[model samples]
Target: MRASRLRRAFAVAAAAGAMVFSVAGTSGSAASGMPAAPRLPGVQADTLAERYGANDDFIEKSERAARRMGDTARADHLAELAEPGRQFLSFDPRDDGLAVEVLGDLAHADRVAVVVPGSDTTIDTFDELGTRYAALAGGARAVHAEMRRLSPDTKVAVVAWLGYHAPRTLSRDVVTTARAQAGGAQLRVFVAQLKQANPAAPVTLICHSYGSAVCGSAVENPASTAAPLDNLAGIAVVGSPGMGLRSASDLAVRVPLWVGRGADDWIAGVPHASVSVPGATIGFGTDPLSREFGARTFDAGRGGHSDYFKPGGLALHNLALIGLGHGEAVSHD
Candidate 1:
């Protein structure tokens, strides 16, 4: 009876999330001003300076476009994020959206952390001020600050990679990996570009919630990739439902896998299994923090779902340690 009730609750939540995704999806197409990226051969930017400059240029154009459309809120937000000292790896402002910001200098950094956010994240959400608790950009900034503080000597950079369409937390799409498949491909390309831009720097993927599914799918499928993933040092998943894989071995990445789950996170209740339906597969498989997943579990304290990157939280501390490549400093269960 208890298990049946849980399933019913998930079904309802999934339905709600699906409705939200539908609304967001309709608006998203008009918001991404640029066409889909072309199939380029080499680095997207010849140098870090060039990348930053190009992004700023794009932001300026986006700002003007936003004003023309009478979206002053978006214009103002872009203006703030496009300040002189800020560096963006990429920026596109159209309907719903994609923006990748570098929290620190990527060119000279010894280690870099790429943060992938989960459900209900959109460019509008990314631009919203004072919602750091719920925004990917704010979360990235906080994580970057913590990384700098914890590893003072290590020049670390954090990239807020809002590159994919995140599903709604209460929708049916949240239960499937279809969006994750597309997101994973995009992530793979971005990571490949990063590697080509800076071959020596160690890159770690810090995937949160549903973002872990993206990372998992990207690494699991090798034949679909244009470039091989040889630059990653580690992959850390926080507050995840699952990674669409049964075990760490299934991820097929030659790096350390770190998994963390906060005590107060409701995702712990998500069934750690998957089932195939007529059109698609529902549910991601094997919780990352579970022993059968073969991932190194860490102590993420008792914070809620979004608290992994919260300032001074144990999860943030551990994440910073991981971002800095100081695995020894991370606390284990």
Candidate 2:
């Protein structure tokens, strides 16, 4: 059985390498043909209004640049982003773009949930209103809405964090930990900054699919300073492949970790094992929902991978409960 597993791992690795080579030859770099954006502000809650203005200016400038370059679709999208009442904590137009948007009153919230997305999530597809990828932003909004519905008196906020260059599903990078490692470093910094801005509010990380690997990496490798993530409430991963760890106990922190998966998620077929190559480790090991991994399981219902955040779904309801620090109320499998 061990030999068979190893052979399967190598076969997948070989296929991934071939795909990587083919894509490298045909596709341009992530940052290629992107318009330059303005500098972003430091993460400071007191200066959020000014920061929002700065990001709006950045979006407008990038919009003009895109327009000049004849990319009307991108320019139109930027125009929508620059519209009034949209609050972006950070915005970078270059390199597949990165945006961190708040869905509620962040300064006054008692609880904050950061929604980290999976693969194929980009600025262009961030909130494609009527599609599965809509969860990139729509999921955050749904969580915020559900939190309000569940506890009207509680102050809550949800952040749609598209702060990394997610790999395409078909790419070799999807099976490797390189992107997750880099993204995990960035997530740690961002969370630290967020804690500094709002020391009173507890933050929860809600990660999906490959985003689960990013969350796992972030938890596995914490900064070596005191209270690096002081007010982290909890972490929940849905539709995950694996968390790049042998067990939940391997996590660096002692916080509560939850895992859930829809019954029909295609990710179920992916190998939950890692193999070390020359310089990188391929695949995230240990299924999060497995007993050996030792994570609290939640009922994700019968939906597919993208339906986790569907309105009125069990997954979304449980996710909202978890994000609100109401783990006791979350339904178990």
Candidate 3:
């Protein structure tokens, strides 16, 4: 993503200055609770009130949600995730009583991939932008094909988790650890629902951009639950800011982890992994891409933040590997 785009992602109340980040540990005074969401797409007025009157209407049931997922036009979750004027954070809607689409036939399948997209991204972005303009997901799609291509025994269902409050543009806050902690509770709930829906399936979470932050916080218990973040064959984070924990080892789940950045990614240059909490601030001790993450590295070339998903990119190719339980790094270009 471009610096200008990054700035636009963040709806910061303060004017741009040198973004100050907290260097302290996760114990920092960051609000370890849920972050609030702004109104949905402030631009268009819902002059005609939504039909559902109950608050729970905003949240859909899992059974119906799964059907919605398979039908693209009925994609309420996507609209909620990218609707401007709403909070830019994305999480599993099933966790928040919101709607979510279920894909993949896990009963007979062997693998699954939950794709989490970053800022300025949408359902259209992956299918439209990445397919024609860039080579992202080229490899991701290959992995899907490879799953069926190489192993007919495995069935892969990839969910585009564009759910989280994105940077709106790119504010240090949007890229920090605070949001993770804030949204942790909801994330856990979402994962729980996903697992509940498909108990035996092995799940892999693929987080990109600020989506990584959601993963970081999800493991830490933003909602303060004893049910730890469990289940997972792997986690792949690309163009990430920082998991804020110093190491992926800190994550409650110990699945194989992978991290890589396009050398040209400006997000890697963002100064402090400063995450502001309610009273104080927190810092992700070290770079998440470090050995601490317990993940192998991939070469994204000069592709910036969003490049990993670009077609024919190694990052996208490797994502297929990770998603398919093939941890070995692969080349796309």
Best by lDDT: 2
- Per-residue CA lDDT of model 2 for 1-333, tens digit only, reads 543564475567568767765643332223345555556667778877777888888888787877777767677877878888988888887746789998888888899999999987777667764574345888888888898999899999899999888876666677789899889888888888887678799999999999999988888856576237767879999999898988989877788899999999998887788888788777888999999999999999999989888889999999999988999999998
Q: Which segments of model 2 are wrong by more than 4 Å?
A: 1-36, 129-133, 221-227
Q: What is the total number of backbone clashes in candidate 3?
A: 33
lDDT preference between candidates 1 and 2, better one: 2
lDDT of each: 0.80, 0.82, 0.51
* Candidate 1 structure quality by residue, lDDT tens digits, 65-138: 67776667667777777778887776666665678888776767799899999987777677442358547887
TM-scores for all candidates? 0.88, 0.90, 0.62
**Cα error, candidate 2, residue 131 (Å):** 1.0
Number of clashing pairs per prediction, in order: 11, 0, 33
Error of 3 at 194 (Å): 2.0
lDDT of 1 at 287: 82
* Candidate 1 vs. true structure, TM-score: 0.88
- Estimate, for each residue in 202-224, the C-alpha lDDT of model 3 and write its tens digit: 77877776677777767642345
